[model samples]
Target: MAKKKSDGVNKSQAIRDYYAANPKAKPMEVAEAMKAQGINVTAQFVSTVKSNSKKSKTTRGRASAKKSVAKKPAKRATRASKATSEVSLDSLLNAKKLVEEMGGVEGARNALSVLEQLMD
Candidate 1:
């Protein structure tokens, strides 16, 4: 077991290095290897350390120089027009029921015409 300095920072680096060296090694195996070298760590701890190392590495160089872009809001009528192109199964069933209640297909068409006028 190698003696750590005043702070225990090297343990995390050692764990990360072990993961790099044996990418397929299980968490328990990593813990046991650390145990052999006189550092006590759990499998969960190993997983946490590994994940944090990955996160830190990914975020290190990307935060400062990035620019935030303001996006414009989309037009509601355009979105609604796009939405009307596809009819879902539930909507079809409801339309069928409404047509039956109105006494037939012609009644449904008349109802739809009134609804379209109301929307405008």
Candidate 2:
């Protein structure tokens, strides 16, 4: 079967209607919808149209940053958070010193011996 070429209109009226009914939809979504409905618009064409529509709407509009304030945290864990899994030598040293001042070397050794157990 042969695919008929579009008549080379500036804007496909069907696509405009589809977008009007589904405002805020992505270009890919429109492309998929057109494909499923057996229309001939390409994904690139849909994307281009969507971008043009957005550009026209925002020609005199304020910058997007002025509309909303958003703070999105990084998705990956940081080095400091991973440090939680490893016991700090400084913490262990402080604990040992406290124990020894209260008693003696034996108390310090006891504290060091139980460091792993205490960390858990």
Best candidate according to lDDT: 1
Q: What's the true lDDT of residue 114 in model 2?
A: 90
Q: Report lDDT (CA) for all predictions.
A: 0.76, 0.66
Residue 24 error, candidate 2, Å: 1.6
Candidate 2 is scored at a TM of 0.35
**How displaced is residue 81 in candidate 2, in Å?**
70
TM-score of 1: 0.45
Could you tell me which 10 consecutive residues in candidate 1 have the lowest summed lDDT? Answer: 71-80
Against the true structure, what is every candidate's RMSD? Answer: 17.3, 19.6
Q: Which residue pairs clash within candidate 1?
A: none
Best by TM-score: 1
**Runs in model 2 with CA error above 4 Å?**
1-11, 55-120
TM-score of every model? 0.45, 0.35
